[model samples]
Target: MVNDPHALHHRLVDRPRLTGLAFAPDGTRLVASVQTLDDEGTRYVPELWEVDPAGERDARLVTGSRRGDFAPAFAADGTLLFLSDRDPQDPPGPALWALPGNGEADRIAHHPGGLTAFAAASRASTLAWTAALMPGAKDPDTHAALLHERDRARVTAVLYEATPTRADGMDLGPAEPHTFVLRGDAPPVDAGAQGLAGAGDMALSPDGSLVAYTRAPTSTAPDTNVVVIADASTGEERRTFSRPGHQYYVPAFTADGTRLICQRLREETYDSEWQVTLVALDPESGEETDLLPDFDNWPWPGRVLPSPVPGDTTLWFTGDERGHRPVFRRDPDGTVTRLTASGAYTSLCVTPDGTGLYALRSALDSPPRAVRLDAGKPDQEPVLLRAPGDLGPLPGTLTEVRTTGDDGFGLRAWLVVPEDTGPGNPAPLLVEAHGGPQGSWSDWPWQWNPWPFVARGYAVLLPDPALSSGYGQRMQERGRGQYGGRPYRDVIALTDAALARDDLDAGRTALAGWSYGGYLANCAATRTDRFRALVSHAGLWNLEAFEGETDMHTYFREIFGDPRTRRERYEADSPHLDAENLMTPMLIVHSGKDYRVPTSQSMALHHDLRRQGVPAKFLYFPEEGHGIDAPNHLRLVYETALNFLDHHVRGEEWRRPGLL
Candidate 1:
């Protein structure tokens, strides 16, 4: 249906996307990692662009190559440093490159393996990064020797000694990740440690003397996260902040370097509420002071604003509150205030003086766009920086549907109604279940977006039900231990409430979901036949089967107890137990490489449906994981889902996608 390239939301993947924002220390310019579609349209290529944060002039691309550049960072001497491919033959070299304020770019360092990520101190000359290194290798020569030995021995297999053999991005490697430090003209040093949690968890002190990185729990200590502080130059361990049943990561040094700011979330039972808070660590005394204790905020561990001015460490961070993801500023004197009024924000950066703040804000109807915030103003509306990813006028208008749940709890959802929706021409309803049983429909989504459906004359309802986040832990507690009970009630209750609107058609309705949402979609199909058709993407069918083969076996054990011992809870939430009652048409979507939910869940569901004579179809992505990643695959996803809905709900002829 969205085949036309000029269609409103057809080219969302082809647009020039912006991310990885960096502001120069002097606040003269801001650089961002912009991804543009290649000439062949096979993949997106990254390049560095300078955005005018002050909104004075247009943004311009700074560097270019066939292999592309990304992960922009700045050194204290006004030198711009980034990562790019140094060897065209190798492709994606991820070698460190530096470009001075007024000079040609030159390669600084290229590790044996490709670079995973890199970072530079906000106010210091020291630079540090993480890359793949042969396990147990001490130095460059040692790493090279180990690689040679592996090749000589013809060993190409992995022996599992850890619980997480693979994750979303990479496999458990023959060469593990390691850290490196680069300071001035000196040669880079082997830091003898790993950053553990990507570049976000690593921090460099303002003075550039100390580097702080997080150490993931070893086999012996499997439940705690350790924050390690070390000498930046020598890589000597200085101190550690760790405790059992607690996590301490997202490290950031205050402007003075005397104190370190980080987030800590205690390990609680499966039914307990997870309330992560911001804390300031006394690097010398080893004491932590709660920074945002009074506010209802769950600090995002991925990013924290870095203050460039010394002794004046005013921090800005985004937190989940209700449905909006807004920015909150914490002053040195313990005063906490929200700076942005609305919309979800990420990639927060600040000017050198800490007076100007910059971030990208997005909503259900809009895509991510660069914006500036006044640090001095509280609850200020952000000023648009006018960069790329400009979605021209949408084909729909957005509204919210609010009501009370069966338990007398407040419920809400973002309702996207087509522009032509009216009583005489009501739009068909499509209720989309959000992934992450705990995640809310708070931010903009390029993948699970609603505009495309609305453009096709569908009114989309995105509900934050009992298990969703941003509404305090009690909301999740309401559905915890019983995903199919209370959360399903909230979902259907909110859907019925939305159908009561004049612009929506109650007679024609469908359901679609992924991950945990997919599980709930299956539950809805079995419990009630109100939905004309249901689409489940990577959803769990049998909890008992999924608990053993899924990636996070321990996580499931803690959530519902071991199915081998306490099988009651596992059997209670599983959708397969009630599959005999399913009558609605099902479009089961899954991937061959999905370790999170496993492909077996959807396979079993499709088999059961066919044997029972229930109309069903299974769509598979052989190379994709739990979620489809490639832009080409995503286009197929939308097309296939829309085609299925059109046939089953609208009573039109079913037309399969080309790839199908």
Candidate 2:
């Protein structure tokens, strides 16, 4: 039950709720992007904040436009390089911009291919970035491209290099695009399969001749055969080593450039069993050794581990192998030493000198706060940094639960019961499923469904079914091809078990999810008309059509199997095939700008439901994409969904005027 507003996880929301925090070149100021949700609820802006580790609020508003800016990096000349969607000439996509640290900024380059600025470079007067090539751009889909697409329409990704200006201050002709694919029509990437694998964070070696990056198998098949290495000077790729059964997230070069230190995920979960490993790579020899192979992996699934101390071979990172993920150090001798011990930590960044560790720490009941960790003694407490506006403790109760599915597989979930739920009356149940059939929602702050549902006298069920991360490798890979088969069965089994209890309202059950969960909701609607009402966000309809339009069609075809080849299987499992069976009145939410699942899927379903005379309404958020980011839009979405559920399920007349 969430009585405290911050009942989810303390470290997740704690003050100086640091995001996109980067250290300046001289380590003078820590630049971070702070998300502030305003009063009107329409404008949620993330402003640039610069704070001196010693507690200075020199935070300036670098981004002045209506569009959001984040992922700031300080260039060699002290100019700030960042990603923004405010380019005057381009559509709503990330573009590289250079802003003077002291004065007004100017546009550097406009990527026609769309922005995927995972990494950028600026040395002397030259500026470079790694991005995706747009369709119909230069011949980027040549043999040397990393992305392998079966069809051009469905292929939305291609690696590119952008050179803003040469070292001589002269504009370097035009952007040079290079596809990482093999030469000459090798075969397009399979649908539902990974084309070319890539690294999230990349680093240019000190010499600038070699590029070091993390290489994970592009496919989501749990190919731990991934590792970080440097591209050879001969234009050949030299793999350092393979790290099977683990994920290598962020990579950085050592000061010497001969070795690479990367943040490796030891487990999918963040709690007691999770571990973050710091591995050292010998680029020249193509060899790698885990500095701490036996280290305990933390429960934080997506948080990046801090790179090892700049010049030191002994890697230092913040992880809680002892309890929660806390700071720890690994000696060259493989002896794992625990660092910061007290509160739960979610994210941290260490300076190049290792003198200070900027961390975001929170307790079970406390919101996360920024702290500067000084490597001294265990008894030495960290210096508290910034304290944003206070959001008093949430009014709720948080309980961790472990439930097993029909297959007897262990499922981990959180049950948030409202503080107002008394012993006599069983609270209405609302089951919230996470997206990313491959993504996990563990230790995540309650922003939308769970929090709001609990506030309205509903118990939220967040079950980490077989496919969710945080458990282990096997758990995540369990429901791969069993999309509508096992996973759906698991959900029903879990719900049935829960409904059997006298504490939950069996007649008022409501199901909700986004992306993959949307697909699941579609399945639930058609497979069984158990729920009184349904809420689907960006739901996927017509998997057959999706295979042809989705960017990763090749990959999807592989997993779901080319629906054409396996038409029977596809139809039998796809919600679109059995849509006629759906009897529940459902509200479908979608963003017109969505590319991952596309708006067409939703449109098709809406039209069909209307034609069939089924109770269905489609809500389109034109100004948004995938998920609603604007505060006003978010409020509208949440309020509309709740009103719909209350009217249809709770038997309450809560619809506002002109809601349709």
Candidate 3:
């Protein structure tokens, strides 16, 4: 029942993680991937667990293995299919495995480069998955031979003639991913290469006659993906659905198979805020209709979960609203119904009859848990089906704070007050900024959980500023070209509003952020020294360096313009230029492998702060990425961050974290 940071961390890391959920054809059984730490606690092993959706029986372990198994899909014939890294153990690569509802799992199909993603058609009993294909290899056999030869010869060098030679959390590729199809007991068929950027958001037709996938036209412009519908049997392109400046993905065919419904992002400019809309396309006529024409909220809310509700024209999706992610259902007539009142939902799945909806719900005080939604009664509380992780009681109470920024825009923030905080004993405030500069702090963040800080008797403020999504398009435009302008002001304005409350202590405040939040933290340090302490994790300090080194160079150039040509935006918004004004004692955390906001940004900031005699400490994780994922590394991150705040904000003696 412990609620402290260390205890919470231990509980979180050791708990069985549930994800990748799928329901059987009869809707009687639901399958989910359960991930648990290995005996040594170095890594995670995934197993498939079957549970009765009716909650009549206890969850049963369907598949037990030390190897990682995930991406569960049920075939039309009641066969359970999943991707596993089981046998031929030396070099582990995912292969398709099947369970016949009452027998041992059997390998159904294998790939040379390992499966990345897969989708199965319930009616057609067909399977499609994406796998990497080696350069110059025409078939899987050739690809496998090339891999074997490379392993034998110890050939590790990768020659990239593409725009992105390196990617975060992946090896530099000599092999490009392509989709493949597998029919019952038949030779696997190549559905064709999805350009150099690989395939994503693959959806198969109910009859298994057509395969719809999204891929970039060129390797240089990976962000500009277009949906392509092709024949599953012959691998022949039938139709290409795309607009000149828009990106389309997540194509799902209607149950009747007349139209393809998916998400479309209007490509205005690299720097401009793109509007995501639900669009339905008549596969025959090529006419596209904006389903939710007036819906301004971003449809793809939270992590990239399953958005489309199968077997009906009605689609269930999530959108951000006033610091909450709520579920919304769009009828075939284009009428949108707001389902859940509050809280964030993801990994959405609807029952076969379309009457019942299921998803994982979470909030500021709760971790993700499986819940069944009453589609008819939109306001009803979701029935909690299961929660694998043991998220003990909250150490604080959660509330919202609202204020209008200097620009007349309404700003909203979530305030977490420690249980001990009140009028008699106000708690120190920690104003935490969210990343995405374009993203909102709405969902339950498992990786960057705020419970640790709340457990430490500090009140945490999470604000949605100008550039945050789910607020209308106008809100996004507020901080578009200017990074430090309205967004920074909105954060400060919200913080001030929160501090006005009797329960929050304003005098002992601190600012902390990661990624874009990190960028804002840097911006805050330069703009004002009101806060006693500041922490920036993988934050962007130099605009010029970030544009050049970031993976999305074209996107950055579109927003800020080229540093060489659009010099004004960079000079005006960059936090590094105002380094001389920084007076707050800072803690800079960065990972060597953070390609998006390269480690160089942190290095530059740390060096500048030290040179300017501004007290600063640098915590570097050489083996980590943009976000810390390793259990030990995550624990150390929280410990160090809390210690930094305790020293500067709470005026406690500094104690270095053991690893540091």
Candidate 4:
């Protein structure tokens, strides 16, 4: 078995990734979405897998098809329902499918623009999902006809009256996303227009009387969201709850159906660190209460899980702290207790009796795997459940490092070093900055794994600098509206501290980052010549241009305080301003469809590097967006990145990446 870090591509491309976990109504069985690369290695083939939560049986495949299935949920009647794009009889678009426990899956309902999300009620067996409805096309048939006509004519241009003309990983809309309800076997019922264009996070009440979802009221500032509660039968809005300058998402109702719990973030600024808190709101009275008033840790910002125990006032959540994303529980009295010790957990599900809690756990050293935890015992360790396959061993080991930043703030980082490195044979360092600028390096990253570099004999530094969560509100506040200031210094401080160790070599080091980290890498290239090489993937170049071209223009406008008024910020933080100072051999990677950072950013940087007579190479992926996902493309990404670092940092002969 090839378990080496450089050979991780083999494992990553072939290994089945588990996600979107859901528990049965009785909690006896668990179903999850397992995605693997297809035979041609062009796209992922997702299938539903069933696992016996009792640990008596190994996980087994439940559903399979070429188009794939995902988002599995059990209806109140023990019928399994999922979203799929596998209807050969019809043109490919996600449609609702049902599995009657003992029979083959059957298509239940079809949506023309495809279903973006789905939700099911636990008690009433009611279903709700979101689908894009084209303007002037009131029904699915009309929308389908419009889509077919557009495709037949090969028309690609889209007319836009909206602020966001396009989005990442999705085509621009001549249509708006609306919610619909599936009732028995009758034709699907239109739930009316969800005023907010792209409504998501649909949740049905336990009694199936109400449907609650989150959506941004306007297209300009799509980040700002509000929760809407509507009558399930008529699809008429009963009430809407939102706080000014706050974003609400993942709204779930309490067992008694009086209150809705959701993750809420107060929009302090455009670039403010998101310190998400769980808030409970009375759907009727619009009264809101912060469940964790004094808790400083930022809750996990990815997917929100429903309350572990129904009818219980206590709520369980996950948060980042120190260097770990741990499970936490907030009692009815607002007292918070930490549960798991040192790993990241997501897709949480609890037994009906609340005795057992199950989640997909992951860490720096491990990929996501099924695990069971004792919900009642906070101190008990989680037991790993049998997954589809096993990852035998790791080629490297991870250690935690701490240092004081320039501003006296404590900094933490995860250092992944190959087992072969020691005092006698120190490894070259690769300082990796995480994205989000507000995000942390607490969890295992599948897209940008560090093992490949370790396998290539280079130590990887995963730093959580200023603007990183898990450190508390103050740590987050330090990087507000100043991405290149404190955060940059924090990363350098940590790198310097790590270099002081005997196992790491300071003379041969490189810096790499993606997204905001990519922005930081660009900033580092201009600010310092400390590293031998640098890699910037989907990084930001010109602040003013980025703000204008980015999908979230309003958010950027708020973050930088209007480029016209804050010209100083735009000039000071933008990497292009200091491009002439870049001295390191840099590799720039970007995708044509990356609307988040935009490919123009990379193109600008490449032009500057060429004009300045700097050694630079641009690896452009026309088919990818934000990040590379296709198997062959991913292989080229890692091989090129590693080869670049080997040539510059390790003084190895340059070998151009294969299949490029």
Candidate 5:
């Protein structure tokens, strides 16, 4: 399992992804959602599994189907409710299904476009969900009829008066997302969303009296969001949280329903970067309490959960700090403590007794798994519970590299080297850039997992340059409006730090990245010629064009300013403007459906490279989006990208796939 690249590649692309942790009302049952490659090996199949909460035994499968079952939750009666597209032939998006102790799972309710988000109250029988509905449609029956009319009329184009027309890979304003609440056995009632904005990211109070949710496209920009709390049964607004230019969202009610714990982020200005903070707000008085008033790291508000113990206002969440996302516990007295020793965590849930937590953690050498974290024990490793199958050990050893940038800024990177690599046998190196430019490479990402490359004897460097998260806001502010300046230099500095080691071969090196990282890869190719090969997946090339057409124009404007109005940065940083200087062989990967960076960037770069007679290859996925998430396509990606690197950096003959 350690030395075989073929077997590693299979597991890397096909392993089950576990997420969505939830404990039943009585804490007797702990369950999660696991997605694995279906029987046909073509699509993913989601299944509900009840794992031992005590962290002692293997998980037990609760239910499954061909169309898929996901997002497991529990009502107060100990009944399990999940989202499933059980009728595959009908193909209506996931409908709500409930599995009781003595009966089979049955469809409880469904909407026109199926369920998007679902939630169950901790101590009550209230269930709230969100789904798409045609404009002005009040209920599921009305929405279904309207949908049928649209299909009967062959409607394809959407009419939007003010909202955005597109976002990343999604076409906005087709069917509006609406919230619905089911209190008793009657029916789900429409919980009127704030104005015309869509509803999602909701939380129910412990007593199930109030449902708090966030509305998207906040009637202004994508950055601004409003959290609104409404009556669970009547669907009437009770409270709304918002500010002039800042965003307050991801509302989680405390166990006693006295305080609402969520996150707040002041919109970025020209001189400062966005800093996210965890905050607690009084539901009735509207007073605010900064949970992490002086805390530096940005805690993810979506993972916030409150302990159910009486009078305990302690909240648990996770955040990226340095190269890991560790679970954090915030005590009632304002003391914030980290619980897990290492690894990235999500799907956080508090134990019924409020003494511990269950979360999913992932690292470079392992995939996501259920783990137990005891409060106030940051030194102890998370206790892992046995999952379904045997995922053998990976082939590499985790290590770190660090250096000081030319500007005196500290730069860090995660290094994964083959177990056999040492002074006697130095291995080739592949430097991969982290995306976001604003996000850090803190976890094991299945799409860009490095173990397969390590299994093939190539050391992988995951560098967090300027503009990355987890670091203080200043580190990210250093690269704002200057995408090509500090980040590129920081990458080179970190690469030099890695190359200085005895276990790595400096001469055999390759560069790769997607999105912002891809932009940096292009910057490296333009400014330096130290690497043998480079790969850019759905990366930006023309900065002005990308900011003008990308779905996240709102985000780009905050960082680089308006390309039309502020053309200086775009002209200086656009990769296409400097493509003539690229010397190393490059692989350009893009999906036809990728609207985030757009396929046009890759096409234009490929055209430029071919015209200049530069050695390059283009891998395209027509049916996939920005992620290229299809199983077979992912297999091809690993085969093709690694083969390209092996041929150029490892000095191996090109082993192209016979199918291509």
Candidate 6:
């Protein structure tokens, strides 16, 4: 049997995954990087595309092909700077490149190693990108190998600029690497230190005196703090007040350079507690003012919301508190106004002058599209910048159902039924779980996700079980430290209710999830014989092993209780302990380089399943991290999962044989 799910010639497929959006310096235009999933599954030819804020025409593709190009930003002089993986020298990783605003493009320079983050310098033609250059090759299988090599990989942030007379090109001449020391490691040299572990966002004050970025320890917890102001010249820093319980992210500076705005995390919940409040920070005095109402939480590092009104205390940011992050305007005095009320926005960026806001919006039914919101006239409707030809229309008649699980907990979920519903026609059911036992499944759009399940004649059920964010504080706390217990019961009960409906095919039921969802899939397999098949991407099977193997171990006690003190409790709840009960056939996929849920968890599950003579197959991805990073990997994952489900659920003979 064929292992690839896309093997079926007429099957509907979602080949392109869109993410990483940015706006031109002037804000009149925007660019985004999109991942395409074709019949081949996953391939990364991150195409850079341009869109006008006014949805006058479709977005135009800027970069072409799988050689890879993404993360585009226009310089003050109108030169576009973006990251490309076309470096034959680097073997499929990111490198800095430049293009004339008119579309002429050429490579600038290769990164020192893995180019993790890149931001163009404000006012100047200079650009900066983060790199991690390892000392030597180490096996990715062992934790010691990863730790040793990761430690050996000296990280440094470097600034690069095209030489003079190169407005149309990147002059790789003047490249300078900035260095720093670990807290107690050295004499604090500014060159050779890991400044920000996960520094994906960066902002420069208009005056160019101060730079703001998010700093989170890569090997530690996901918590972050905002580093507000740093002398761009000397690297000396001043921080905003320590948000005691919050991890500050995406600290942005206003044009005047006096006030800084940032996104701060307030509380940890599976859902809505994370917010994007417009905070005002005095760069010099380190004082802060909350200029926006405490609204539903948003992801850290505020999205460059609608452009900031020059000299006005009002700024724009996105938060899901009111639902899925509709763009909101926050005035200095703390009045919040909604800008776009229709679909959920994933990314937002404002122009420097504050006259216009460029945003990307996608619904559970569609792929992301670019739009321009004019703050100058609030009543003006958003202009659709670009909509791809491939983006299919959303499903018809979606329903949000509220049902009580057997545990008596009120479970909220979305039910996407086929339009052809009729008597004696039961649709197959696919239960999709969200990761981040701390993460929630929202009413957000699903392009490469849920929509695909629905498109394939499967009734998709996405439940916001206890620990989801939208409801409030209490609901989110219900699942903490209760993994594989009440939460799993809530899901099982939900499934039972769905199965009771005559329109759902109970005999053809399947379960799928990523990250924490991965853990839950394992939980469902061992917990009950309800599902006919299971698909776990970047999933975890062993908790005791994960506690010490993951980067988030610092908070293990907070989420799963202390493993040492509660060994029996941890073991009792772990999927590894229940492996013998995992009667449903399962397929496991993981990235070799994933640090969050390291590959070993999958390895552990595979080894145990093999020893027990269970039906299972494990696919390992090379050159990828916790998530699917390339088209090839994504293709392999999707195809394997779909085929696996087809085999067990539909009684299709398994084509690709499993190791077991």
The C-alpha lDDT values of all candidates are: 0.79, 0.58, 0.78, 0.80, 0.80, 0.60
Q: How large is the C-alpha RMSD of every model relative to the true structure?
A: 2.2, 9.5, 2.5, 2.3, 2.3, 8.5
Name the Cα RMSD for model 1. 2.2
- Superposed Cα RMSD, model 4: 2.3
Model 3 per-residue lDDT tens digits across residues 553-578? 66677678778888888898899998
Candidate 2 lDDT, 44-73, residue by residue in tens: 555566666777554455544233677777
Model 3 pairs in collision: 271-558, 271-559
TM-score of each: 0.95, 0.70, 0.95, 0.95, 0.95, 0.78
- Measured on C-alpha atoms, candidate 6 has an lDDT of 0.60
Q: Once model 2 is optimally superposed onto the true structure by TM-score, how far is the C-alpha of residue 448 displaced, in angstroms?
A: 3.3
Per-residue CA lDDT of candidate 4, range 1-660, in tens?
A: 122343865666567787768888777678877887787877777888888787778887884432488888888777888888877667468888888767688887777757888888878867889887777887888988999888999986778775356554356677777878765665666765554345467788888888888765466445566788888887788888877677887888777778888888865474555557888888888899887777877654444444535667767778778777887766677777778887888888877776678988888888888889877567456898877645558788899889998778888999999888989999999999999876788767767788777877889999999888888888878878787888999999999989999999989999999999999999999989899999999999898999999876666777787887889878878889887897889999999988889899999999999988989999999979998888778777788888888889988888886566
lDDT of 2: 0.58
Instruction: Indicate the residue-level lDDT of 336 in model 3.
Output: 76
Which residues of candidate 4, in runs, are more than 4 Å off? 1-6, 63-67, 185-187, 195-199, 219-223, 268-273, 300-310
Candidate 5 stretches with Cα past 4 Å from truth are 1-5, 63-67, 88-91, 194-199, 218-222, 267-270, 299-302
Q: Ten residues in a row with the worst lDDT in model 3? A: 300-309
Could you tell me the lDDT of residue 641 within candidate 6?
66
lDDT at 160, model 6: 31
